[model samples]
Target: MELKELLDIERQGWDALCASTGASFYGELMTDDAVMILANGMVLDRAGVVESLRDAPPWRAYEIDDPRLVDVGSDSKVLVYTGIAYRDGAEPAFRGIMSSTYVLTKAGWRLACYQQTQISQ
Candidate 1:
């Protein structure tokens, strides 16, 4: 996919998180074997992601910066970016380098993996 398309998809994900629809959005967007390596040191498979997001609070605001796209092969791509998200009543925003990998599938490009590396102030 092109950079714009990839970034749009990423933005959609962030929007979903802000709207408290992440569990459903991610469930549909993720591949069966998808995994998310969270900033909290949890390595979650697709099922785990669905469960966790069910109770996760929505983010109030978010931004993605310095995004770069990498081709893994002919049918796969990865997005790397600096992301910052804030929630109400939180001391600090969630600042991190986020990575998302997508693989082309018959249904469409599906998320194969996602990871968050927390950035320290």
Candidate 2:
């Protein structure tokens, strides 16, 4: 898939997270064996992620900024970007850079890995 399309998927994933959609919906764009490295340095596998996010608090807004694509191979690509997270009646919750790896499978583009690094003021 083109970089723009991949970026759109990334944005949609962020939207889904912020909306606190059910785990099943959140898992649709991800690989069954996907993993995520949280800003707190916690590593979570697909099941861990789904479980944790199943009851996550809703966010007021989530904006991904300056996404750039890195083609890894014929079947894989990586997206690097910064993002801002907003919550109702609270200060911005997260200012961070994120990297997500997408791999083409029989089901099309699916997120294989994701990592986030918080930016301190």
Candidate 3:
């Protein structure tokens, strides 16, 4: 896929990731080698990422804002954004800024890495 097409797919993936009430679709979008650095400094691999979502209560709601895309090359790109995640009955909503890198693979564009830092209001 072209860089522009990959970016569009990534945007769709981001929305799916944020809005996923289940882990399957989200996990499918990530590369097998993908890793995520959580706001709490925990590092999660592909399985771990899926497990985390599987173990959490469904997200009541979520929103992503200011998604800025940076082209790293013809086949690579990075997206950065801030967002809020709300879970049923959770207090203080989870607010954070995230950066995710995507790379074109034979299977299409897959998330290579993701890192998120908590934001305090």
Tens-digit lDDT track of model 1 for 1-121: 3778889999999999999999999999999999999999999999999999998999999989999999899889999999999999875578999999999889878999999999984
* lDDT (Cα, 0-100) at 70 in candidate 3: 81
Best by lDDT: 1
Residues 53-77, candidate 2: write the lDDT tens digits: 8888877888888988998999999
Local distance difference test scores for all models:
0.92, 0.84, 0.75
How many pairs of residues collide in each model? 0, 0, 0
Which sections of candidate 1 miss by over 4 Å?
none
Per-residue lDDT for 9-83 in model 3, tens only? 655654555566446755887888899899898999989988888656555666777878788987778887786
Scanning candidate 2 in windows of ten residues, the lowest lDDT window is 21-30
Error of 2 at 82 (Å): 0.4
Worst 10 residues of 3 by lDDT: 1-10
- Give residue 11's error in model 2 in angstroms: 1.3
Listed in order, each prediction's TM-score against the native is 0.95, 0.92, 0.79
- Between candidates 1 and 2, the one scoring higher on TM-score is 1
lDDT winner, 1 or 2: 1
